[model samples]
Structure formats: C-alpha cells, structure tokens
Target: MKTNVKTSPILHLTYAAVCLALCMVLPFLTGQIPQVGSALCPMHIPVLLAGFLCGPWWALAVGAVAPLLRFALFGMPPLFPTGAAMCFELAAYGLVSGILYRKLPKKVLNVYVALIAAMLAGRVIWGIVMVVLMGLNGSAFTWAAFMAGAFVNAVPGIIVHIILIPIIVLALRKAGLAD
Candidate 1:
C-alpha cells in the first residue's frame, strides 16, 4: 500500500493544524527585537510549508485563521491592522504556493518557482490589505511605505524562506511525506 499526501484529508488537516500552531509560537523568537522582529516574518515559514504539505484550501484556511487566532490568544500583533493585514497576506502565500506547486511539475526548479511566486503574491496582498485597512482608519499607505514593508523590511524573511522552504519541502518529498 502507498499513501499520497494530496489524497489524505486527515494528514492535510493535521499538517494545517500544526502550521497554525507554529504561527502562534514562531513570532516569539523574533519578538525579542522589535526592530528586526517583523522583518524576520516567523509566522510565514509554517504557513508556506502548509501550502506544500497540505493543499491550497487547507493552507488558505490555516493562513487566514492563524493571525486572528494568535492575536486572540497572545495579544501581540494587536487585532486591528497588523493582524488583519496578515490574515490576507498569509492566505495569499499559502494559496499561491499550494496552487502553483500542485499545478507545476514536481521538480526542484518548480519548487523555487512556486515559492518565489507565492512570496511575491503574499507581499502584494499584504500591501493591498494595508492600503484598505489604513484607508479605513483614515491613513494613507504610501508607495514608499509599501515598498519598505513589502520588500525592504522583508528582505531577511524573504531570504530565509528562499533558503529554508524548498529544502524542507524537498526533504519531506524525499521522505515520502509530501508530494
């Protein structure tokens, strides 16, 4: 008998749950330095991995819920803008990564392609959410702010993800845990 990750709902649900839990915990590591904390983007890794291990819908659900749930329990990110913006951003990361990974060939290059695309899409979604949320609060989300938040401040996390995610996914694939 053989197991396929894509066809295993229980396995996906378990993985998504684990990813959601990681979202709540990982931020604590970077929270020590408020300056570099957000830049590290601790919550992103598990969410992106969830997309690869689970499928898009499960990953999206995990991504969307993780922030709000974390804020509800931890009160770290605050519920208004940061948490709300993250809801969309992480959702995009998981959705885009899962979708692309599923659609593209299961090769190393395709993993990078999907991961990069998901990161870009997630950042864009984050910027959009910031614009809408800030506008609702009667503030402007300037292009400079968007650039800083979406790319400049995020460089560390981006590099970390680029380095870490594919390795983990590929390792999981080698271990027969991921498709």
Candidate 2:
C-alpha cells in the first residue's frame, strides 16, 4: 500500500512555524551587515518559499505574523509603519505565490512565473500600505520612491529569489519532499 503525499494540517502548521522562524532569524543575521539587511531582504526568502511549500493560508499566516513577532522579540523593525507595511507586503507575496503555484501546471517555468507575479503584487501592496501610512502621518511617499525600493534597491534580493527559489523547489520535488 502506498500513502498519498498530501499536505495535512500538522504539516502545514509545522512548515509555517519553521518558515516564520526563518523569516525572523534571517533578518537578524543579515541586519549585522550594514545596509545589506534592507537591501537584500533576507526575510522575504522563507515567506515566498513557504508559499511554494505550504498552501496560501499557512504562508499568509507566516508572512503576516513574522514582522511583528520579530519586532516584539528583537526590536529591529519598528512597529508603526515599517512592520505593518511589511506584514501586508509579505502576506501578498505568500498568498499570490501559493495561489499561482497551486493552480498552475506543475512545471519549473510556472514557478518563476508565480514568483515574479507574487513579487510584483507584494511590492504593489507595500506601496499602497506606505502611501496610506505616510499620508496619515503628513509624510509623502512617491511612486518613484516605491519603484526605487521595490526594484532598484531590491535587485540583489530579486535575483537571488529568481535563482534560488526554483532551484530549491525543484530539488525538493526531485528528493520527494515536495509535490
């Protein structure tokens, strides 16, 4: 008899917890290097990966909670706007990636497509969050600023995600760890 390789609640929760932990720890480790932490966006890797590994809801939970949890534990990302924006951004990333990955054909190219779409959606959500938060505070955030942060500053992280995520996912599939 063969067992079906389906994701159970326990597995989902376990993976979400692990991903959340990684999200918190990656930032802390990268934060030691000046400018690299914000630029490279270490926190995003695991959240996106969780989207691929787990389903949307589990990934969303990890994404939504990680920033605040990190702030509470480490006091790195201040609670007000940055953490809040990050929450929305990462939540979008996880949700979109998972939805696309789950719905699309099980092919390597689909992974890249989903990842790219998720990245764009996350950035858009981040920009929207920043606009509202900044506007309410009498501060200004321009589209140009959003573009710079989302694309220019995050080029390295984007490249890393493009190269690393698919490779990891494919490896997991090959190893029979992922479907």
Candidate 3:
C-alpha cells in the first residue's frame, strides 16, 4: 500500500501563519533605514507569496492584518497613518495578485504580467489614497518614486518571492495541498 504524497491544508495554513508572523517581525529588523522606511518593507514577500499560493481570501486576511499586528508588536509604523496606508496597499497586493492569477491562464507570462500589473496598480492606488487623505493637493506624487520604491527597491524581496512561492506551490500541488 502506498501513502498519499500530498500535503495537508492544515500544513498550508501553518505555513501561512508562519509567514504572517515573519511579516509582523520585519519592521523590527535592524537593516531598516529612515530614507526608504517602510516603503521598502520585506513583509510583502510572504504576504504576496501567500496570495499566490493560498488564494485571495487568505492573502487579503494576511495583508490586512499584518500591518496592524506589526505596528502593535514592533511599534515602528506608529498607529494611525502609515499603518492605515499599509493596510490598504499590502491588502491590495494580496487581493489583486490572487484575483489576477485566477483570472488569467496558468502560464509563466501570465503570472509575471499579473504580478507586475498588480504591483503597479496597487502602488498607484496607495499613493492616490495617501494624497487624498493627507490633502496634499499641490504636492505631486512622483511616479518615478513609486516605481523605484515599489519595484526597484523591492527587487530582493521580489526575487525571494518569485523563487520560493513557486517551489512551495509546486510542493503543495504535488502533495495535493492546494485547492
């Protein structure tokens, strides 16, 4: 008799939980700098990976909750403003990635296109919301800054997510853990 070679859903949940916990710990890490600040947060890796692997609801939950928990635990994001912004932005990363991934065909090109598109859209939305909430009418948001911060600055995190997520997803798929 051969045992099934599939991972359990409970295992995936455990993996997601660990990733969320790691995300919550990132702001406390020592390499954080004042110039980039949370703009270059590494927490996004796991959350985005979670969305890619687990689906939208899980990704949304992790993205929505990570900022609040990180602020509460690490105390770097303060309470009201930046934390709120991240709640929207990171949640958008998760939600959009999951939705786009699902809607498009399962190809590497589709995956990358969806990921990059979601990243751009999510950053723009975050910036727009910030401008409105802060009432910075005259001051302009630099799209260059947005691209630099959201993509260029996050290259390492992006590579990490790109490499790790697919492997994890494949493992889960092989193990029959994914839905």
Candidate 4:
C-alpha cells in the first residue's frame, strides 16, 4: 500500500522560525567566551534542517537571514564583520548540503557526506569572507586559525547536529512531517 504522506509548508516555516529563535538564544549561552561565542552557535541546525526538508533555497534563506535577524533584534552578532561572514558561510552550508544530498546515490551516505562537504565548503567560504572582507588586520590567516575558528570551536555543535539532525529528519519523515 502506498501512503499519502504530505509535508506542510507551514510546518517547515514553523521549524525555521523555531530554529532561528534557537540561534538567537545561542549567543546568550556563550556570549562572553571571546571568539568562541559566534564560532559555535547552533544556528546551522535550522538551516540544514530546512535544506533536508524543503530544499536548498529555503535552507539558504534561513541561513542567511537568521543571524542578521538575531543581531538586529537582540544584538547577538553586534556588528558587521561576523554577521556578514556568517551570511556566506551559512549559505554555503545550505547550498552544498542540498546539492550533495540530491546528487549522492545512497540515503545512508547522503546526510553524512553532504554534511561533511557542506561543513568544509562553508568554512572555506567563511575563511575567504573573513580574509577578503573582514581581514585579519595585521595578523595572517593560517590553517590553524581556520581549523580552530571554523572547525574546532564548532565541534560540539557539529557533533550535536550530526547526532540529532538525521534522527529529527527521520522522525519527521516517519510522522509525515518531512519528505
């Protein structure tokens, strides 16, 4: 028997809203941790979720807007450099994830492969944005800093995402909340 499961746009929108709000709250949890605060924000979760559920564009939209909105509303990001940097990075993540997932053949490999690719690509974009637009001032941009800022600092959040997001997606799929 074929099941007539349908995914709702409103539900996806609600998911985006909640994820954006969660991103807003993340700053509070690490606001005083020097560079660590912005580096490890859980905002990426919603963006990825949107991509996995809706499509690349929706994910990109959520990723691009969430940080800026949070900054505007709650002063989380505080200024231009980090905020602008994140726009590109987050957008890359969404775009890469969606693209990779669609192109890959295996469902088991899809999320992990896409996620790793997205993470790498997003960080490359983030590093480029920081160096080109934000600049390191007198300091040079190195692999260590890139890895530290782009990857290491985000390790926990990355772990959280890898562990939780697929399960969430699967649950949503099972409950007829996702495609």
TM-scores of the models, in the given order? 0.95, 0.94, 0.71, 0.80
Tens digits of per-residue lDDT, candidate 1, 8-42, equal 88999999999999999889988887788879899
Q: What does candidate 4's lDDT look like per residue over 1-179, in tens digits?
A: 65443445666567667666766776677666776555555778777777777567667877888778988897767546778888888888878877776677647657787887887888899999877754545556677877887888888777777887778877876897766
Q: Write the per-residue lDDT of candidate 2 for residues 40-152, one digit (tens) a residue.
A: 88889999999998989888988899899989898968977889999999999999999999999999899999999999999999999999999999999998899897899
Ranking by lDDT: 1, 2, 4, 3
CA lDDT scores, all candidates in order: 0.92, 0.89, 0.69, 0.74
Backbone clashes (count) for model 3: 2
* Candidate 3 lDDT tens digits, 1-179: 75432234565577679769878766556256665545446777777767666567778888888888888776756655567777888788888887887788777666676676656666777776666645544555466755765678777656665666566655655786653
Q: Pick the winner on lDDT between candidates 2 and 4.
A: 2
RMSD of each: 1.6, 1.6, 4.5, 3.7
Candidate 1: pairs in clash = none
Model 3 spans with C-alpha error above 4 angstroms:
1-12, 28-40, 136-179
Using TM-score as the measure, what is the rank order of every candidate, best first? 1, 2, 4, 3
As for TM-score, the candidate ahead, 3 or 4, is 4
Cα miss at 78, model 4 (Å)?
3.0
